[model samples]
Target: MVWEYEVRYQCLRERDKAYTNWLNRIPHKQYALAFDGGYRWGHMTTNLVECINSVLKGARNLSITALVKLHASQLASGNIQVSCFDRQNEVFKVREMPSGLEFAVDLRGLRCDCVEFQVDRIPYRHVFACCASQQLDWQVYVHDVYKMDQVRQVYRARFRSLGNPTTWPAYNGPWFVPNSYLTRVTKGRPKMTRLLNEMDTRMLRRPRHCRLCGVEGHSHNRCRQSAGANADRDAQ
Candidate 1:
């Protein structure tokens, strides 16, 4: 019964007709139900394991030892807190965003919205999300996701330039390059010097002035007037 549940629940695709027929043959009398799960969801049983899956989703291809190391790294990574920008408040809050999934961090708890946070004490993606969000080095995070062995081969391939760069694999459709810095200069464009001269420098770099306190040295947050105002409120 456990084997059947593992197969039906965990396996990638359920297209095999023989596997489906075999599941039907398992008699209830032959097996003792050990686990107590309340009312199973019909068809696919994903909700039952979503939390676990989220924890393992990023490093699904890793070996058993690698998985254990990944878990340990996750636990340790949680303590390393960073600042998160609150756009609405226009201030930086001292909070930890998970690695890799920093873009999806919950403003309230500073936690990743992924399921790993619920099941395990820490989500592995937090490590990657935090690094990416803060623009910190993410090589270690990538290493964790695609194990060292896989990364080694990838690095070797890149070093050798083994595969054909142009006219290579088709991804079925055009893939959008995310977080790319490359910009293309089309033909018949204005000269670079002319374009730079046409720009309004004032709009590009705002004056170092604080609207809240009428200051020059610092922004509103760090201004002496703002600090004095807050202190006055606390005293009252």
Candidate 2:
């Protein structure tokens, strides 16, 4: 049953420490939906999947037809194969077709043995069948998060562009120099052990300016004018 994300993680950690340790190397925000902080807005994968969809637009109809056929088959399964037994008015024992596996659905609690209800907080065919048999309002089981007002707000504001890089202000930020000693051999032909990358050897940042004169080439302490000024001030 769709356990809480953190609960599931804790269980995994307890079950296998090695797997969890391997997982710990990667950032949580990159992999876990719970840690994403609503950035995806229910979109699991955007760019890569969207790129694939755009490339496969011509052959998309075949997949669509297959999905429709699968949906129709599932619809039949809901209607003919599934039967529910009510326990008072809150709990239900649903017996499936063929396999005859039983699932307990708690109406008041908004939970089902099949995790579809708990994950999306939306009623699926099983929950609908259960509600239908009892003549209970299934809409009451729907979470408020799915309301039109909330859904509309997700796309209400348009995304603004970052604008031209040329128009951007001169960066006075700290330079992040990569440690040559720490760098492992990446993709490329390996050379002499003594040789490092030419790019790494060079200072890739803007030239330093003197603090006193704000002129490039030398630091404030080393500036001739700054030293002369200090000497003159000392003589005075």
Candidate 3:
């Protein structure tokens, strides 16, 4: 409950900030807002599992094939219904438009032209249909998908089962190497001697300038004159 309150407060604060930012330019008395937690806010905390459960309420007694067939039918019918709405709405908005682009999405009527929403009536799919048709980038509309309280419940349960990381088991494998065996090693050959030689040749070909001044050998980042108090030490 405390976490839910915190989340609600944060949402309210964010909305308040956005309102303030936009209203700064206009006069204060332009409009009045009712403090009902910012339009559809209460619904943000509820889980849609109840809706899904309602749809499958009688499925507990059904056979496996029946259940699978029912769900598949539901999903298909829902998606297609929503797509239909998307097509129609897009057509209405633009007269003589191509049939492929116009989607009929009627939110006010709770009728998504797509089959998904028409069959299943899932709100998220309606939003998805609308986003897809309108190119609104629906991933950013996350509040429609997850509830804060549910997220809190998950975190609480995880911590209760796993405890904290500070008490985790220490490494149990062998950790030491033999020191005497290291002395017998020879200096390894360079993997790309020719490449190193070419790089050196390029450097030599460059005009000799103070590497510190980008004047041939140096860059401003390493310039000696810019060394100020360290100039004498640099010269030495």
Candidate 4:
């Protein structure tokens, strides 16, 4: 339907040279077909990257050793296992016993039909199954970036101990300066409470009432009797 709309738009706006040119230039493969070679797997957005950023936001202030230890502990906590495997054209068939789903693993291509291995760059259950069948070390298939050894190497460089602040070298640099333009000014006293929108007002509102007669359903400002009374008072 979207593609049809684009095609219809091109026909309807034939005089629109830029729009026509843009529509013509759009490739069929880009919109009509899936990504070739499974490079993207099934992920279509940066939600995964955003999720990782959110997860690590809390640990950003932590020391390097603490970060490494946190990651190591998380890695150790995962429960993945290898079930049976079969060999065909060097493709190993692995079954995730828990999910009861089978996946084909290509050791040469370093890809699994399930797609998790490619995305995570780690040996999933299917890859594990393949390793178990061949009696090969599964750790070899895992990317070095995730390995404990690589994580340990990050903390190997010790931070030099700092002596007393009194013994520190005297300041040789220019005085610190603040940018005046970037400084924030009071924006009419900050609002701690949220302003009610139309939906919120509708939900929170009490039963409507006529202030003129103290009756429900209408307000005093809109009351016909009040208007008539006001007119009579003005005449008097």
Off by over 4 Å in 4: 1-89, 95-102, 152-236
- Candidate 1 lDDT, 1-236, residue by residue in tens: 35665565445236666755665577633432313232333112344455566677767787999999999888866654545666443223234434532334443343444545444433355544455566655453232434667667765753545477686786698787765456565656555321111123443575688879676756788788889999999999
For candidate 4, what is the lDDT? 0.67
Report each candidate's C-alpha RMSD, comma-separated, in the order given.
32.0, 25.1, 25.4, 24.8
How accurate locally, in lDDT, is each candidate?
Answer: 0.53, 0.72, 0.52, 0.67
lDDT of 3 by residue, 124-165 (tens): 654665666666655544443265766777667534466688
Query: Which residues of candidate 1, in runs, are more than 4 Å off?
Result: 1-38, 41-45, 80-236
lDDT per residue (tens digit) for residues 118-219 in model 2: 999998877887878878888999898989988999899999888999998999999999999998978766663222222222444678999888899888
Off by over 4 Å in 2: 1-89, 155-161, 167-236
Better of 2 and 4 by lDDT: 2
lDDT of 1: 0.53
TM-score of 2: 0.34
Looking at model 4, report the run of 10 residues with the lowest lDDT sum. Answer: 33-42
Q: Which has the greatest lDDT?
A: 2
By TM-score, highest first, what's the ranking? Answer: 2, 4, 3, 1
User: Between candidates 1 and 3, which one is better according to lDDT?
Assistant: 1
**Could you arrange the candidates by lDDT from highest to lowest?**
2, 4, 1, 3
Q: Compose the digit string of candidate 4's lDDT tens values, residues 33-77.
A: 232333442353233444554556667679999899877766654
